[model samples]
Every structure is written in C-alpha cells, then in structure tokens.
Target: MPASHSSYDSGDEPRPRHVAIIMDGNGRWARARGLPRVAGHRQGVEAVRRTIKAAGEAGVEVLTLYSFSSENWRRPRAEVDELMGLLRRYLKSEIADLHGRNIRFRMIGERDGLAADILTLIDEAERMTGSNDAMTLVLALNYGGRQDIARAARNIAESVHRGLLRPEAVDDELFSSYLSTAGLPDPDLLIRTSGEKRISNFLLWQCAYAEMVFIDKFWPDFDADDLAAAMDEFAGRERRFGSTANGR
Candidate 1:
C-alpha cells in the first residue's frame, strides 16, 4: 500500500533510523495471569529481545529502551533487588548473542545509583560491544527524561562558567551536545507497549517530532510483526518539521 498523508501532499515514505520505546505494563500482565510481578518482568525481558531483533531486522540504526526508571527505586526493596538481579542475568546471558549480531550495547542513567556488580557488568558490556557496527542498542536504566535535561543544563552552565562556551551561543543544537545522547541522532519513532498512552519521561527533548505508536499487546507478547506494523504506520506519516508537506 502507498503511504498516507493527512496534510497537503505526500511523496516518498519516511524511514525511521532511530526508535525509542517505553516498555510498560509488566505488572499488569502478571497480575492478569495470576503470576508474581517478577514473572511479568521476566517476560518483559523476552519482549526486549524480540523488539531489539526486530529493530535490527528492520534496518533501524538505533533503538533505545526504557528498561528501568529512576522512580522505580521507590518500589518495594524486594522488587528492586529482583529487577537488578534480572538486569545482571540479562547482561550475562545476552551479551554474547548481542555481540554475535554485531550490535553495540550501551546504557544511560546514574551509575552511582546502580549496584557495584551491575555497574561493572554494564561497563564491560559497553566496552566489549563498543566497536560493533550493525546497530546500537541503548538501555535507559534508572533513567528519567527530566533528570537528563537537567543534567544537560548543568553541563552547559558549567561550560559557560569556564568560558568554554558563551551563553549567547547556546542554541538548540549547542544545548543538545551537552545531553547524554550527545552524539546520537534524535529518535525518529517512539513506541510505548502495553497500551500506555503517556510518554512517562522517556527521551523528552530528543523525541520532539518522533511519530508515536502505542501497542495494546503486553511487552512479552509484542514481537517482530508488531514492530513491523508500527514501522508501517510510521512510514505513512508526514513529518512537517516546521515546513509544509510540499516544502513550503
């Protein structure tokens, strides 16, 4: 099928190079099945595997997943410990497979907040996969978009104070260079699984024009076909980017 344009004109279909996702509803999925919440998290890991493979297959250059939010620490200590343990297990089990696929793995968030062992594993993963060229897999663990922006602002201020950068020269592009995702391209598409309609503090500044896709399927159940459907939907969008469809 040809692409759809809700605006004035349509031309070639758009292809998203980078995609970000907010994986939600694991607890709900577990509760619905009368299973423990940890079970839901385990299932979510499977979903992450499927989604990353799908993104790679679809020719997406970058994929960012909100694995754990900073606010997640407020949950019960047992759950927190379980989540961290699962993260370590995933890194240990998946790093070899991910390397085989030539995918670069990276994580963002406050390293100080992570357990020492987990932090070591995360650093090792990045170093091992740093040279891979196929695709980049970014995991936003213990991340919060607002916090990210705040940190960027703080960096920018420090630079200005040090006379490295003039406050007057700070534009969007300049400011973006101070962000954690400094060298990365903005996400072209943003997906939220488990039917959550809100962004929930994922990629706040970086996803300004990203085409949003919300899928009803729980994280564990969303697979390649679901990602393809989202891509198809994205390919049919018209990105104005402050200009008309016909390039006014």
Candidate 2:
C-alpha cells in the first residue's frame, strides 16, 4: 500500500527501525494452565529467543524488551528468587550463542540493584558483543520509566551545578542524552501482549510517537508470527509526527 502522505512515500512500506515490547500475561498463562508461574516465565524465555530471531529476519534494527521491573521486588521472596535464578541461567547459556550470531546484547536499568554475579555477567555480555553489527537486543531489567526520567533529571541538575551545562542549554535532545538509552533512537513501535492496553512504565519519554499495538495472546504463547503480524499492522500506520495530512 502507498503511504498516506507523499513526504515519506518510498517504494517499500514503512518499517519500524526500533521496536519495544512489554511482555505480559505469563502469570495468567501459568495460572490458567494450573502450572507454577515459574513455568510460564521459562516458556516466556523461549518466546524471547524466537522473537529475537524473528525480528532480525524482519529487518528490525533494534529490539527492546521489558523483562523484570523494579516493582517486581515486591513479589514473594521465593518467586523472586526463582526469577533471578532463571535470569542467571539465561545469561550463562545465551550470551555465547548471541555473540556467535553477531548480535549486540545490552541491558538498561539500575545495575546496583542486581546481584553481583548478574552484574558481572551483564558486563561480560556487553563487552563480548560490543562490536556486533547485525542487530541490537536491549533488555530492561529492574527498570521503571519514572525512575529513568528522574535519574536523568538529577544528572542534568548536577551538570548545571558543576557549571558543565547551563540550565538554559537543557533541551529535549540534551535531556534524552542523560537517559540510559542515550545514543539510541526512540522506539518507532511499541507492543503489549495479553490484551493489555496500558503502557505500564515501559518507555514513557522514548515512545511519545510510537505506534502502539496490543495483542491478546499471552507472552508465553507469543512467537514469530505474532511479531510479523504486529509489523504488518505497523506498516499500515501513517506517522505524521504531529503534522496534519495536508502538511504531509
């Protein structure tokens, strides 16, 4: 189909260069199946692997996933432990494979809050795959949008106090550089699973103009086709970027 506006009407359909996802419904999937939530989480890991491959094949340059949120610490101790254990195992087993595939692995969030071992593994993964040029996979662990923005604000204030930056110099671009996702493009598309419509603190500032797609399938059941379908939906959108149809 032709683009709604001629401003960006190329021969090929519009595709999102950066896609962010909020993987939800794992607990619900497990509870409905009478299985422990951990089982659902494990299956969700498989879905993550599949989506990585699928996204790369689909020409997506950057993929960001909302994994463990900071609020997840409020869950029961035993469950949290299980989740951490799974994270550890995933890091250990998947890093080498991802590196071999020429994919860059990155994690964004509060590193101090993560266990020492996990932090070590994350550093290693980032270091090993730092030069990869195929695709970028970003996992948001222990992340909160509000916390990220607040941290950026604090850093900006510090810069001004130190005379390194003036209060008048702070603009949208300067403020975004202070964020954890500095140097990365804002997500062009955002997807949420399990029929959810809320953003749930995934990417508040970055997704200001992202096309939001919600799927009813639970996260554990998500696969390559679902991602492809979401892409198809994305290709059909006309991003005017606050411009009117006549302007485009």
Best by TM-score: 2
Q: How much is the lDDT of residue 40 in candidate 1? A: 95
Kindly list the per-residue Cα lDDT of model 1 for residues 1-248, writing each as its tens digit: 21232211232456688989888889999999999999999999998988888788677889999999989999999999999999999999999999999999989877768888999999899999999989999999989899999999998888889999888999999888887887889999999988979999888999888899999988878887778788879887888887887887
- Reference-based TM-score of each model: 0.93, 0.94
RMSD of each: 4.2, 4.0
Please give the clash total of every predicted structure, in order: 0, 0
lDDT value for model 1 = 0.87
Mark the 10 consecutive residues where model 1 has the least summed lDDT: 1-10
Most accurate candidate by lDDT:
2
Give one digit per residue, the lDDT tens place, for model 2 in 1-248: 11322222353767889999999999999999999998999999999999998888777889999999989999999889988998999999999999998999999988877899999999999999999988999999999999999999999999899999989999999999999899789999999999989999887999999999999999999987788778878888888888987695
